[model samples]
Target: MAIVALRAPLKDLAGGRSEVKVDGASVIDVLRALEAEHPRIVGWILDEQGRIRRHVNVFVNGELTREDAPLSADDRVQVLHSITGGTA
Candidate 1:
């Protein structure tokens, strides 16, 4: 199983759990596992077409990953929400 580390808002949605274990082979599978636990998370991480939202980033073992990125049993995944700001 891969350990998925959740960002603030995602963690909050997962009942304060910062990490979750997912037995999956790819990023999509991992996200599906997370969604299985916290149903509302799907909308937050994926778009209507089931693609990862542009505002969200996924990292596998400290490297950025795409939806098709493969996972290992000992791999660690981090799901983050992008924060953007501009000078006024």
Candidate 2:
């Protein structure tokens, strides 16, 4: 299982969980498993096409990764919402 770490407000959506372990071969599979555990996070993490939303960032072992990126059992992942500041 890969350990998925949740950041800030996103953690709030996961019942205050900072991390979760899920069985998956890729980032998409991991997200699916997480969504099954916390249904409310489905829309927050994935878009209508089941793709990682543009505003959300995913990292595998500290390197940015796409939803299709492969995962290993001992891999670590982090999910964070992108923060953008408006122009003055």
Quote each prediction's TM-score: 0.90, 0.90
In TM-score terms, candidate 1 sits at 0.90
Q: Which stretches of candidate 1 lie over 4 Å from their true place?
A: 85-88
> Candidate 2, residues 1-88: lDDT per residue as tens digits?
9999997677888899999889999999999999999887878889989999887889999999999999999899999776743245
List model 1 lDDT by residue over 4-88, tens digit each: 9997889999888999997899999988888988887878888878798887889999999899998889899998876642235
Model 1 deviation from native, Cα RMSD in Å? 2.0
* lDDT computed for candidate 1: 0.87
Name the weakest run of 10 consecutive residues (lDDT summed) in model 1. 79-88
What does the lDDT read for residue 14 in candidate 2?
A: 88
- Residue 64 of model 2 has an lDDT of 91
> Candidate 2 — worst ten consecutive residues by lDDT sum?
79-88
Cα lDDT, model 1, residue 43: 88
> Which pairs of residues collide in candidate 2?
none
